[model samples]
Target chain A: MGTNPVPNKKLAIFTATGCRACENAILDIHYQVSSLARCADIAFWPYMLGSEVRDLEKQESIDVCFFAGAIRTSSDREAALKLREKSRIMVACGACAAFGGMPGLVNISQWSVVSGQSQRTMDNKQQTNEEEKPELPPLESRVLGLPQIVKVDYLVPGCPPTQNFLWAAIQSLVCNGQSPARLSFAASRLPEAIAQAITSGILPPKGSIFAGEKAVCASCSRVKEEKRFETYKRPYQAYEELGRCLLEQGLVCQGITTQEGCGGLCTAMGQPCRGCFGKAEAIFDPGAKMVSAISSTFDSNDAQEIAALVDDIVDLVGTFYRYTLPTQCALFSTPSKD
Target chain B: MSDFEPKIIAFLCTWCAYVAADTAGIARYKQKPNVRVIRVLCSGMVDPNYVLKAFASGADAVLVGGCHPGDCHYISGNIKAMRRAPLLRKLLEEMGVENGRFRLEWIAASDAPQYAEIINQMSEEVRSLGPFSPSTIK
Candidate 1:
């Protein structure tokens, strides 16, 4: 299924304004595709001298289009469509373009903002409770990233995807004629480097396990505590316990469950992995991760009780997922076409 | 202490809280006549801003009542409602409204007695919070 080698591949790196993350991603993409520099012509928008080639007539036509932000404006949609029309391959260049990244969160939370205006109208009391909400500002006024408004050919999810993932995507498309998901990180690189230093050989490539899924959990060991109990009267601040798996520590994993990617950075820094990787497989769901991490830490728990515990954790953390997604994560809110 | 009776707005879920309010009326559970109830399909459908709007529009207080968790006629509607309640309460509190002025209760379709109790408790709480002033409007 490989297409003919594009001898004169034109790669246009499309980016929106005010995103440092997109800038970082483009730099990484440039590094990976440097080998193709002779055959490929890459250009960036807004910052780069992209205005010269803004229309189709001026420069070399694009063969591969890399989008960097969640597409918000009609112009953005037009840009994506035009790029698709010109390019043979379209890649959601970074996390922002891929899942709608942080921009999708804006879309979800937008309801609240609209509701806020609704409150103002209600306060104004124009003699009707059924009054229509004020019209949302034009798409340009909203800070929509790419996927929010257009269809993406490939995704690389992360606040900014790791260099390896971004490189892998470009190499796959360039060298292998395939496009993979905008993966947060390449599983190939992990605790192995540390394991190599510790064990004098690479760690068994198998890091910690969560719910029988082979994803690594930095706080896996702590969750295996043999005894568990619940006390309801603690303060909200009491939820913070240093160095224990959040669930094992009897706190919510709001960060890990809601945020995507990174070896659960907050967990590594001695905080619970809040569910930041929204509704991921059990390997990532903080509740599911806890069941595995804690079950491994402790022994002999009532199965039914454990199930109930998981449900309660889901109930608590689910809000975090919902909060993060519609308001922040691009994967949930980015329209499929965008 | 103007002679004006405070206005209260209640957003009730159709399947549970709305039915419970209807039952309260049917069973002759006379509570505050100042409360106006608007029934929605589900409590989750009552957006937080709508409740806030009620307050901005001269409502001294706003009450949202839904089916108990897991008992939502539309499965998980009450859970969504529950999640929103605490946040809205916090929001109102930060905006300088007394925490008790905005309330969220879980009342089942058969809980007519509980409906009466909640309305009475909320009406009393609103009464103590005093008359609505446009100064709080934002």
Candidate 2:
């Protein structure tokens, strides 16, 4: 038989510590690309060569790259660019890598705060101490995630995306001509048979879609319809009762529509899922998750009425989405006067 | 009076805090029984969430003891920790927790007495604040 050509490919995966999504992606990659795994190498953070991965402008030759952390600081962006340069294909692996994740939510507020502080410090210096300093005051900066900084190739959206996606992507790269097929679920929930097939090494057929959107309050079987309230009584207490949807059961959904996977972990626990799946497709303008949800819940025509209704859920949003709220979203609290 | 004991959680760097704590114990320094110490390789290894989780799970106070800025066993690890701690302190303040509830103290490996003082001061502050009720946690 004629000699079979071996695929020439190298892979390196970078991740942040304590990131479950990155950990999961690594595991999925192991299973999916087991056949040609030797071609790909993995590098965890800090262990990466050089003082800063981002400092290296042009990365050496490689085939695929996966960055699995929130690229908030300039250092992370530097690291990402290096990885993108080294690879023929690049992908931002988790929620943070994809659209800034929780860190992005802090960008607007953090910048303003830093700017305000620097301005105050400068004014104070100019008044109190006339000693010569730098010609211009130093500008303060905060971390902004990927997509905020660089042009990303592909985004696997998830607080952590599923392992299936990770492996599928890697396997597609190394297999060259043997791109594996991907299966899709109609609802967020994966079917038992499909789950088993995925676990058993049975490559899913391409173009498969699974459909089931049953986790949100709107999908809850226990809701009596008429019991659904327009606003929450006491937001924190709204997540306590099981066997009832939070919204339909007189509680706010806590941005459940934004997150996918976990079959609605918060809803199942009687709590709401804060939109941890990055941002939903249509709401790209800042604070889209809250804005869209608020609009959908009230009479869009009456801005005053909507604001009052939103105020009821404000505490809920703050408590449930604290780390994820960019100051911009906070400022976007009321309907715009203009 | 014993019931007024504070529940303190100390995150010590393996190279410095752990050694300093050991030195204090070996020197027979009397420390309050309330402080629970956790040893990590470097202060940089300590996640801000770990400190937050400690408070959420019932720590009356949290202490991060590391080497002096340039004295870090792992070079810039302590510096990064310094950067992280103050921000965490700010976050705690915003959440309405007493600002003194979280402390970042630099102690050399030989400074066992300094380590002892930190625990004593932290305990006193926590005790003065009284118990941390669930309602007190944001």
Candidate 3:
């Protein structure tokens, strides 16, 4: 009797305009690396596999592509288009690909001046062989999240999504979550319901975020109390209250409006949540949501008092839209075909 | 720029600003026909996304008209809008939205003249700014 055989899925790891930490996160999956290796064949990971001849133009169609990083350079955009053409399932891994991570701050600052500064700061270049280093391509006008450049099937959000959430996404995509999701840091640490759903062996709907739907505040292990803000301070200024909600301490925690799944990693370590996870459910703009959500909790509703209260927020854009400006900003998003 | 009739997207709160618009229209108050109004339940309900979307889709100006502070029927809805407007304005400006392109003002239900005057003022401001060219932002 002949049995139906399933071919292994071809997975490509593509990266551009990022810190390359997402690639490391994938490798840091440590104990489960073999499980992932067994589930899919590495088709074209130029960064790690050292397999040159990137001419993906001739390779058989790739099954899934883990695309990490923003499209910042002409070469990056070109490669993204080529990868899109060759791959069937495109997963935007990490915040840069999904929402233009910290690097996206260049979108606000003068990108040209920034690039100019970079050239002046490359003092260590003489140590390396002059011809060995690749010429850095001129950056495009502004950084754009993956969706801005091409169609994206799914987004795994994070600065570089936590090792757990990312591994979950890979497992879900390749194994249909048939394998147990529970591990020391991967699934066992997640809220029970989320862990259950991820490990249920069902492929989530397309366009789904491979993270918790709840706001980061839900997972934040901080003592909750009524919040009535009178003053806002930078994290450095707050020296006393260490364990209470950062927002209550006026440290500008975005967890109240941010979608969770990193397990409030930064907030857990006495730092405010930077909202690397994009918008929470039903939030159209995290900035607008944060303003409304935070302002309502203010102790004083008086106009003068409130105006002063708002002045304490040092960088309004960096606080809420830190990760999402590229896709949400009208500047780049307008010309898209979507 | 003299003949330019800029497109303004106005998010008017239903209780006050929307009522003022209706009153101005019924009373035959002279107001520029440039503004395209989107009425919301409360000024606070107009998410910054709405304003950002308006600009994204080619709105020349965005006017968020709400009730005067303490005049909100829902108690403190305008207060919330008050809280968000300045920060949203700063954020949008940082993203390259010109000043005059984004505004939030209190218009009472009975202030039809003020509503008409405000529209004319906004139209003039936007006209002077020469239509929102997002290119300058980059």
Q: Model 3: which docking level applies?
A: acceptable
Most DockQ-accurate candidate: 3
Model 3 misplaced regions, further than 4 Å: A1-9, A53-61, A109-134, A175-203, A239-243, A330-338, B39-44, B133-138
Give the alpha carbon lDDT tens digit for every residue of B1-138 in model 2: 447878998999988888999999999887777799999998877766577567757787888888887898888777666545543454455445678888888889999998887878788888988866433221
For candidate 3, what TM-score does chain B get against the true chain B?
0.95
Candidate 3's error at A222, in angstroms? 2.8
Task: Give Cα-based local distance difference scores for all models.
Answer: 0.53, 0.55, 0.79
* Candidate 3 structure quality by residue, lDDT tens digits, A33-86: 887877688988988886543668768798889999988888888888988899
lDDT of 3 by residue, B1-138 (tens): 688889999999999999999999999999999999999999988887788778877899999999999899999889888877777777777667887899999999999999999999999888888878666546
TM-score per candidate = 0.48, 0.47, 0.84
lDDT of 2 at B86: 40
| lDDT (tens digit, per residue) of candidate 1 on A91-142 | 6655456544455444433345745764576566645544664443245434
lDDT of 2 by residue, A47-136 (tens): 344234543344457566666766544445556666766666666666666544565444334356766876788788777778874333
The candidates' interface RMSDs, in order, read 14.1, 18.4, 2.4
| Per-candidate fnat, comma-separated | 0.00, 0.00, 0.50
Per-residue lDDT, model 1, residue B87, is 43
Residue A285, model 1, lDDT? 27
